[model samples]
Target: MEQNPNKPKILCVKISSNQRFFILGKEDGFSVYSCTPKFSLLFCRKFQKTGISIIDILESSNIFALVGNSKDPNFTTNKVFLWDDLNQKSIMEIAFPTPISALKITTRFLFVLTKKKCFIVEIEKRSILKSFSINSPSDIKPSNSFDFSLVKRDSLHIAIPHKLRAKIFYTNITKPLVELTIKLNTPSYQLIKFNCKLTFLAVVSPSGKQLLLYDLLTGELYQKFRIANKVSKVYSMSFTQDDKIIALLFNNSIVRFCSIQLNETTNRLVKIENQMKNVYKKNLINIEDDTQGICEFNEWNDLLVIYLNGACYRFTFDEIEKKITDTVSFNYLNSKEVLESKFNFNIEKEDERKHKEGEETKTGITSDKLNENKNKKTNENIENELTDLVELLEEQKLEDNMEKEKGIF
Candidate 1:
């Protein structure tokens, strides 16, 4: 029961931050697709059996960072290639001592993470801008666990977990200008992400079963929510460009999308699970292996998920119906028309929409404060108070659902 070696299989997907392009790393090589104005297969590069394990595109450009992986890898695991699609060649290459585990490319720099060290490269100059190392590093391969935020107010922020602690670095240059450190509780964290604003941090607790949110400024835990009560490996987690919503994909048929609300008045980050939506397709995962899917968000809060099994899906939220609808789906392996998808979105109006939503959330939080004054509760009493709150919220949701059903009947 062996699959054909010549058959196409999407190994991973890397989406551009601008929502204009995405790279699909296949068993042969990689292909590029236009994402914003139109969804169409732009071009592809084949490397025989050499497959890309990880890739990061530089803001919808022809240039991208790649790390190869395959039974017969064309490049070594410790090497990274900066390939220029227009030229169809590797414009630059960097060799690391340890196997390159993960990488990300931004407008200014390319961040590469190894098991023992982390290196930052300036894309324009094509030079290693700076390198950082921990006294001791973990041997685990980080997937969507390590991430850095875009430059905001002059500092580029990086988050990497070392010795079970998340070490955050803030700098604008090769030399250290500033640094911030945060430590978590007894449980280990597998995923570490900073919101685009750098105001909040999200991590996976208990091996991706639960999500914990912390304030990056104070390293104070704000909220904790169980993403999956049962055993489900989280495949990926991504925040929208506007930082309004987050998408999480488990190693199953479930892709969960939830709204994120920040109550600045209370300094609380609230994950509205009631607003959560799931896109379920039994074939989303390979089911035979640990091949993980990728999930990302467009500026308009639309979602795109590419599974390793070659299924690509696009989802849109309908505010009028309070629903998430799977607008389009196609398999990249079988369809050359993946680029012909007509789901065009306008990102220019996203800023205004975010402002309006922020105002509405502030209003809602103000009214919620009037209903419950548990802000001053002690940590020792928080467990019971949270239980009561969850029970009350569940009852309210059940009643609302029943009323809706009655109206439909």
Candidate 2:
């Protein structure tokens, strides 16, 4: 399954659970497909470093989606087969450790984050070259839930929410490295969660029913405003590509958009000049449906809104008018639509790829179950030897002490 060079660009939003892979298309169709990972590894290895194909292994079923311009000759999997569409294939043989938390692909590396750790795999070799630990005891508890973004200019940022704090990590290093730790001023013991795009960070405080905005580059607080109490939870928040406005979704079926301005001044009081104007407010058609997640604003200026029931809406922004409107709904589950879409399928594929048995997984441990078994056995042997040695030393000391007492008597 390869991408068609001639098709229009579409955003593919995939959510995986134990049961099925929920796929939301940018065009007008949504479908649930079974995702398995067996053939996905085959496709990835065959196409490794060639940049000829992209493969996405869904978690729910044995099915996978393959997209790109060329197909790999060594790709194989009985459980993994192409979907009905000629352009994309669905694989059903492999599965991920946990549902994907975040995925990013660069020219040099593919990064995937699960609930516990971050995996960095080589795109060219189809092998995990490095693994990074993300969990640490801090004000924020390490959450299995998180999101990541690559800042084009100088850095990469990861946002993870623990019990009450959202920790942000900057992943860029240079001659003079830049790092900053900024904590959100929130109510005591209340969680202040956030979603990050390239330029802006959107923070949602549901306990207080407020949305806070921050400037990523300058570390300046942009806007702090309150939402309605009926808005039970602020599930998702995102900013436009230009950083001119922010969109927020609440549990109460209300979607709100506000205009934003950059107030740069020396005086703190005078810095808060421009007021946010409410652009649009709409009751979601499916009031009872759960929101899938907040969609990242793509380069095309389209904001994706995913509902928990497998429905997704693309909202386009009018910069001149400061208005946001729904552009289209993605409902099609065909392979051709997925192949033709221009959204970076490369990163998405990297996120879904998994290591096989005998191979090294991202945790830096061999995927071979036998390897772990052997390590455990070896550890037991060493422990037994150490225990015996300690006992012998203690007995010898006691014997020496007793002989000295006898000699003195």
Candidate 3:
């Protein structure tokens, strides 16, 4: 079969647990980008040899965990390199007996997922701490199967998928034990995510139609939300930095959000029906082709949905005006032209507005000069009518006086 040209060539995109830096692994090399103001491309560096398949970087740090693809058998897929970007070289390389599948990096430990085992390695000591068996269907699965979070700036709060449930483990390297486990109603999970604060664990079922939010501490369900309709499919879901709002992309077209409030005093997520009340279903972007996409929330609570084809769409939500504006940019990865992501205009709506303004101007309604001339002509007509009325009154008075003077007396 011939390959579809529309297919995206980007291999993988990994966002740091901090949500500040995200790396794009292309067929050639991986480049890091900053999600600060606009999703700006920091720099691009291509490899002279093998392509990078996966990348996991520590939060806002130059250290990266890099994995190469197995297209060339000579370049073993069983190795993960600890790269120092500032020095521009690999400082350490860790090789496993089996090919590695996925990786999650942190300051304390590096979580490596392999064929049938999950290995935990100490970053400082460069020693393997433990290995556990996973009954995952395949050797390699989506890297989202597990997520890492920091507790009190030291402990590691890890969330992973068990048979059909979600497991939460807490360890500070001093004490390791099972903290809590969330009994899930869904048979399988598509992805699991922990908010940056490590307070909430968001789990989406395999169907991606429903969302479950759990209290990371108590392992209790805060509330379940309906993300999409039965027929619609949710491709991506993300939470804002404040954790007060969550957004999701549906049917590769529309994007919607729900309000979530975490009570600080109670240390619990509030339950509100406003989520269903704000169920807006508008096609934010009608893609020409079907594709899987991912969504991210920046510091300003703006929603950014990205596709593998380097197509990026941003929706800026203005709380004061209660309005949303969007902008689209293409070929973001390879192009040097920056994404003018200032969402000042909605393309179709802006065009329609200009057209309406043009029609109004043609009819002498919109132009200020045309309005001034129209008001001048109206004032002249009113003055002439007032003068004629005064003249009629004077003529009537003169006729009355002549009748009295010529009286038959």
Candidate 4:
């Protein structure tokens, strides 16, 4: 198919879990287009309307959530409508008290982030499981940040920035677990990107001088990338499923890629034993006309980037690496010289060093053990959530039957 020279401006774009499809949100309603190996559109399902601003899709399950502008047909920003492409119908919908700023979805739940609060709902039953106030004042629009735990599918966390401090809360708990206080006395950092696997959290400093990546599970300052050149802002970014690669978007249509080494010795799957290699200064070359938007790596590890102009670019990991081959470098911090061991003794040596210096190591070890225990407990909570979800689905079925008796569809 020939490219439309006058195609409607692309508002947003998302790739499927399988990486075989691309979802485009334009000034009109959104469309699903098959992504051919050559990056051409194989099929198009355009739902014409005034606009579709927010779109979240779990393409593997054939489910999507769309938020439309008020000008669109039967659309309102205050509500989210769930659609099943297989049925070609709206299965369920939820109305919020305020207009939604952003949203995310998985097989487990749908997260809606409004200006002042966040709402989480079970997908199968469309039942509200929990909601909380974000405490972001009316005038100061909140920077968007939310993701499900990468280590556990059912766990979720959201970071809300208010002034110099940021509050990060998990869905299963009411209290904030991670509160980031910047020493710069600035209002807040603009960019907060959380890896879904819960491996790391990336944020652009308020001064825009550095990019900070933190170890989420350990709360350690994993690495820092100094920003040499000044840019307007970081629009969006995403970590690959393995948390080994990250892509960032900056002003003037530039996207930079970085590689990460988690410093795992024995097994890559074990989270507790892994440490991060220090990431140092790296020069980034500019990409094509990406005025504004986001980018992410699909499950297949292919890079999918969408711009405000509605153009979507897909590149294999090798292709991206080749393009920025010489633009990346990193450093590893070793405070104490210790021999590398096959038994993953870097952590043990650090504990030993702390003990010899008369500095208590129990607090650090206790914290790591606590996180491991929390992971196990959350796993059990997920199973319980699923059981409750089944009951809620049954209730929905009964309600639908009564509505059918009343001749309502």
Candidate 5:
């Protein structure tokens, strides 16, 4: 289902985890639509009046957050508005001095990212809990990429990569815990992304030649993939909800999926399966002016490629192969109100909390060091020791969880 076919290009596309609805951001405004069964238009809300920069929705709730667009004359870009779609009312609004670089929300907290700092706010109270900077005063610059991970529900980790080094901050504390200095002499231009639930960090190089994955719990380099040198453009890579599979988009149209597993003897991350599928076979001949968009995987392990043409294709994966199961187009239609009964859907809260406890055993940190290392060192010498200490603590935690499970069974 293509929405407005004659409008300007679609800038961004994202799907909720429930797989029932998707959102598209375009030149004029944003639209929400029903995605399951068959593509059906829900409604397109124009921002010409207030101007929205971005929209974020919780897959399991009716909560949505809108950030003001700088280009709009009616609103300031530094403000964020929280809305409840089910109730059809705005909850609250907050403003910041600096422009928001990225925005994310969980049930308990709202995460706002700036070029050098991150702000954590309590959702219900509409008050700031904590805010911190990712860089020091001397080295700070406009950051192009920032990644956030909420580890074990209570701990938030933010990764900011710079020219020669990348800093990883455990936002639960005051200072950065680790600085991963790139050993290579090459000048850096790469983006970093984190699998928030799994605590796996992926870094992609600008030349699209090298990809690295790190396990935050063990502080170990999990795996490395040498992307084909011939492929000049690699957009992004992400881990599936299960953290066992990874998907990578190349040259804007072709997507590759790889399965990750632990080697039995070595207990190291390994790629056990690999497959590649081309999404735009129809546009293969027209490569120059090919429209580009974004690729994302929902909770069900389905890969969705939403293109600039307002076309969305979903690829479902099976043990044997992957297939394109559905295609939806969003064609421009006049603004209209959708009846509540026609599109009413329920998202069970249990579905969102199912894996919270078990996954913590795999990524949890020992609670013993929370006080010991809370305020000890601010020097550079502690960087190397931090990795070793973190790994030791994680190993201790696994042993403890195993003994407790043994007692239960």
Candidate 6:
């Protein structure tokens, strides 16, 4: 993509799965378009841009579907019609059990999590393979709402958090093969949880006051840390590639990096690891006042924080400084003349290097030619000497005095 200095500063905003598409439930007819990564529309509806319109935008995936709920009671059917990117045609509508609470797509399956249950459907066949219900633990009452994250490891694992307990189950099998029930130390059971590589499980308390790390394989608490402020809630948590640094986002504004160390001491039920050491913490960009949305870290390690004022900032983590730096360099060019001069200097240097290489190559060729000439001269001299020797032998063979001397004897 070409970067235009004059181009409007557009911070790519990712719509969460929880939010419905903007085009959905709109009174005024608005056109539906599939927004792709290339910023091109696959299809456009006839509706014009109205001030108030609902567009259901999928997070990360640019595919969007137009959903509308009619005023009539009998017209409550939620039909999800999506534009097929490959075919560039609208596909047949599929009936959803409930208004889709969340939608996730993988290579093999497209998962739609509704308020009632989660449905795993095959993308190619467009058929539901299995349906799983999200429920509370046996001891606890069934929860109406639960947060789940799909885990892809040796087998597909779904981590579901109900009230106080976070349970993990194998999604592929009809019956759950393994189940893990997490019991937190905090009183408020709301856990902001995420699973990393199906091995490392991290959970933050509701207030971001405490963090719990656990090993899913052994069902043991790996480490726990307590933050000072209880007002700051952790929106997201992630581990670096080395697993040494644990990055946490607070209220979608501040980002903190902590060093992770494992303790060797054995504990009774939970294995106590080394305390989480806060290495780096900073608010890369504050968007508390903005109504647009919060910031998130992309897969490219780019930090995208959007402000309510329609201003967006993209930053990358600087390893040396242990801080985030804006991707756009503000002071890229001081003056056009200076930039032109610098470019000309670079061109001149490259041309001079090429000219010097050419001179050296020409010198090498000349030296080779001189050596060849010397060898040719030496060969010519040797040939002349051989010719003289042959002439002398011929003259000696034509000797008439030897026969005359023999006759005198």
lDDT of 5 by residue, 1-409 (tens): 2445565435555565345566665555556765554456665555444544566765434456777554543246677766544323344567888777567765456778776677888764568987765552232212225665555445656655432344443333323454343332224435566663645566655565666666655545556666555534555556666665666666645565655555556444554222232222222222333355456675556666555454555666563444445444443243353532222112223223121211211101113342233333233122233333344444544554466431111
The Cα RMSD in angstroms, rounded to one decimal, for candidate 5 relative to the true structure is: 14.0
**What are the models' TM-scores?**
0.70, 0.49, 0.70, 0.63, 0.64, 0.54
Shift in Å, residue 269, candidate 5: 2.6
lDDT values for all models: 0.59, 0.41, 0.59, 0.51, 0.51, 0.41
Poorly placed runs, candidate 3 (over 4 Å): 1-8, 18-20, 71-74, 137-141, 163-175, 231-235, 271-282, 286-290, 318-330, 337-409
Q: Candidate 3 or 5, higher lDDT?
A: 3
Please give, for residues 1-409, the per-residue lDDT of candidate 3 as tens digits: 1213653246777765545556777666676665544566766556656667878876554557888775655346788876544324454567888888789876557888876677888765678987666544331145656665556434766665554333433333434654666766676666677775667788766676777887766677777777766644566677777776677766556777766668877546876442443434446444643455677776557666766656666677654454566554444555562321111111122122111222211111012322333333322332242233234333543454466321111
Q: For model 4, how does the per-residue alpha-carbon lDDT over 107-166 read when each residue is reduced to its tens digit?
A: 567778887677778765558877766654333224334444322343455555433245
Runs in model 2 deviating more than 4 A are: 1-12, 15-102, 125-145, 151-155, 160-167, 173-176, 187-199, 206-208, 217-220, 263-277, 289-293, 296-300, 322-409
Q: What is the TM-score of candidate 2?
A: 0.49
How would you encode candidate 1's per-residue C-alpha lDDT over 20-91 as one tens digit per residue?
Answer: 567887666777775544455766667754677788775534456888775443476887877644323454
Where's the lowest-lDDT run of ten residues in candidate 1?
357-366
Judging by TM-score, tell me the better candidate of 2 and 4.
Answer: 4
What alpha-carbon RMSD in Å does predicted model 3 have with respect to the real structure?
A: 25.9
Screening candidate 6 with a backbone cut-off below 3 angstroms (N, C-alpha, C), the clashing residue pairs are 21-55, 21-56, 22-54, 22-55, 22-56, 23-54, 23-55, 31-45, 290-308, 291-308
Q: What is the lDDT of residue 368 in candidate 3?
A: 36
